[model samples]
Target: MLEVKVKAGVPIPLDVSFQVAAGEVLALVGASGSGKSTLLRTIAGLYQPSEARVAVNGAVWLDTGAGINLPTRRRRLGMVFQSYGLFPHMTAAGNVMAALEYLPKPERAAEAARLLALVNLGDMERRRPAELSGGQQQRVAVARALARRPEVLLLDEPFSAVDRSTREKLYQEIRNLRRVLNMPVVLVTHDMSEAQMLADRMVVIDCGRMLASGSAAEVMIDPAALRGVGLREAGSVLNARIVAHEEDGLTRLDTSAGSLLLPRIEGAAGAAVRVRIMAHEVILSRDAPQGLSALNILPVTVLALRQGDGPGMLVELQAGEETILARITQRSALAMGLQAGDACHAILKTMAVAQDNVGVMQPVI
Candidate 1:
């Protein structure tokens, strides 16, 4: 368990506590000054926990009860900071070997090279940090951290410097490393998508306090985070069954809302999934839209309609537990006579709802 109770000279303690399972990554996510990075610092022995105990893989790193505070060196942990922190003069392998001085010299170079390959940084060893791209530097940093073979690994906004495409590749590499190494990972990040993709579970913090922690799906769709973070546009999408594939190649989905057909290419039947419809994708209709090419027509009751996403109104409707979106012009809103507490049909194009727009675990082929 990694725990903390920080006062920062305040009247009340900012209490937070959570743990990452061995070989699993638990992402710490929150807004600025939410104490996420601060908490990471505390766990790595840079800052004292003050009141709570801290342990990693059954080893006590901190215990305020007995005043058993372990120094940073003795903690047997590795960390990658937001800065990457590679030496400009040293080659990639040189940076990696720097961390393994604690090991016997005989095995250090080969082990360092092995970890570099683990991060797909093979043949980049001779390049200095100054000669490498931001992503390559990160790979060197990650390789260096793993060189110590620590039981726990902590990462603080590890991908902040890399481009989105590079970040995606690095994300996969980190996930692979965790699985193969079996080292528990604690990631502190402000990016929601990053947290969702990497974490087996998540711990949400705000104002230096833990607010919620659970599986990614549960925590993300929690009512509190949606409202608190001004993420009112965010809503949940439930699984829909693919009932049929049309001759025109459009795929039809039989959801609780009746049926929705999209021009997306067909996938295997019986696939369970979910996707975000960005409140803007939804438009209200007092009656059925005539001569429209749209295939998704949902008979929905207005749950709540509010001013949102610019001139476009946010219409929260129910087709069951799933939430859908419709972005309509204000003129359409007025002409169609839409309002809260109104029963309206929603219409959207089938082709508009791409399968790539959906996200979930892909079924094994």
Candidate 2:
């Protein structure tokens, strides 16, 4: 496990404490200038905190009261930043070999080749940064970071510089790497969809303070937590198993809420997946309509209603054991006579469920 408690003033005034279990990915999410990067740097021993205690597994890396502080090299951390920090003069193989300096001189070349191959850059090992694309350069940086076999990995917006198609490919590569490397990982990102796709748990930070920390499903349904980080839209996540693929270009999933149909997902039968349901896409009605074109409908019990600044209100509903949120106008809510104890049906169109919001679930490392 990786544990940290820090009070700092150099980068940004921060009072933060959190723990990331071994083999778990914890995402730090917030807007710009929210101290997410500062916290990552502090953990990597790049910045000394005014008061802090950082430990990994059973080793203590920093302790202000005990006056024990390890230097950056001593911490043995692997970091990949937004800017691909590769040597402009050296080839990709040379950049990775630099990190393996501790190894025997005769073995460095072969080991660097292995690391480069692991990141799917074996063919581009002889190319320099100027000759490669933005995505290829970032891949070299990732390979170099892993050359030392570090105990923890820190990624700070590593995909922000790449294009959308390249970023999606990188996302899949990272997910595959996590299964093989069973270590603590802390990722910093401002995109909620990216965080939900990559992280097992998420921590929302705002102005150097941590507002909420929980499973990705739980945090997405909590409006107070999203509002704390200045996010206006709220959504919920559902864990489901793919039952079968229909001949009509639809996939069937079995969720706690009910059986759902969506556009064909890239997965085999019996595979696990996570589906994101946005509040605004849900239509709540007192009675189940028979002539609707919607493909998914579930009976739910209203748990609570939170009024917003505008005419809309957020309704919390319980479908089976799972929680779902709906954003409806107050006038429509009153016309339907929705109350805390009322029974309602939620209607959703299949087209409203975008492919970007769905992800194939990965095994816990």
Candidate 3:
């Protein structure tokens, strides 16, 4: 487990405390200049806060009261920055081998090759950073980070530099890597959707303070958390599995809520997936409507209603065994007399669930 407590007033203002369990992915989510990167730097021993305590498992890396501070080199952690951070003159293998300096000279080459292959860059080992594509270079950076055999891993907007298609591929790569990596992984990103897709739990931050920390559904349904993560980005993730692929370019998925149909999803039958349904795209009706163009509809019970300062009302719904959030105008809520225990049907367009929002949900290894 990784535990961090930081309270500082200078250079950057922050008073955040959180813990991440081993084999769990925790995402630090906030806008730019919110001190997410600073907190990550502090944990990696690259930055010192006025008052802090950082520990991984039972090893104390920093203790301000005791005046104990381990240098960055002594911290057994690997970090992948937003810039990729590969050396311009070194080949891909050379970059990874740089982190394996502690290994014997003879073993370094073979280990580098293995790491390259892990990131799907074995054939590009001899290529320089400038010669590789943006996505390939990012893979090299990941390989270099893993070469250290870190006790903890830190990813700072690692996919922000890649294109949409490349980002999706990298997302899958991370999911596959989690099977073998047992350490705590901390991801820093401003995108809420990315956090929901990649993290097991999320910590919402604003101006260096933690506003909320919980599972994706818990955080997304919170009004305060929505303030940090814009309400416009508010949504809930559902656990689903691919059941079949129809002939009309649509994939059938089974969720706790109900069966749903969407644009072709690239996964084998019985593959687990996470489908993100945006609150803004959902329409609720007292009864199941007929003759509607929307292909997906699920009967849900209203769990609670939270009215924000604005005209929007956040409704928490229980769809089967899963919880989902719906953002509707207060005016409409009053018109529909929506309240706790009210039964309704959530209507979702087949295309409203974007391909980018759907991600592979890997089983715990």
The candidates, ranked best first by lDDT, are 3, 2, 1
Please tell me which model should have the higher lDDT, number 1 or number 3. 3
lDDT of 1 by residue, 43-151 (tens): 7888875575778767788887878889998887789989898988888988999999988999878878898898888889899998999898999999888888887
TM-score winner, 1 or 3: 3
Model 2: number of clashes?
A: 0
lDDT of each: 0.71, 0.85, 0.93
Task: Report the candidate with higher TM-score, 2 versus 3.
Answer: 3
Q: Write down the TM-score of every candidate.
A: 0.70, 0.87, 0.97
The residue-by-residue lDDT of candidate 3 on 181-252, one tens digit each, is 899999999998899999999999999999999999889878899999899889988889999999999999
- Poorly placed runs, candidate 3 (over 4 Å): 361-365
* Candidate topping lDDT: 3
Clashing pairs in 3: none
Off by over 4 Å in 2: 9-11, 242-250, 268-270, 303-311, 339-343, 361-365
Q: How far out, in Å, is residue 63 in model 2? A: 2.5
Cα displacement (angstroms), candidate 3, residue 121, comes to 1.2
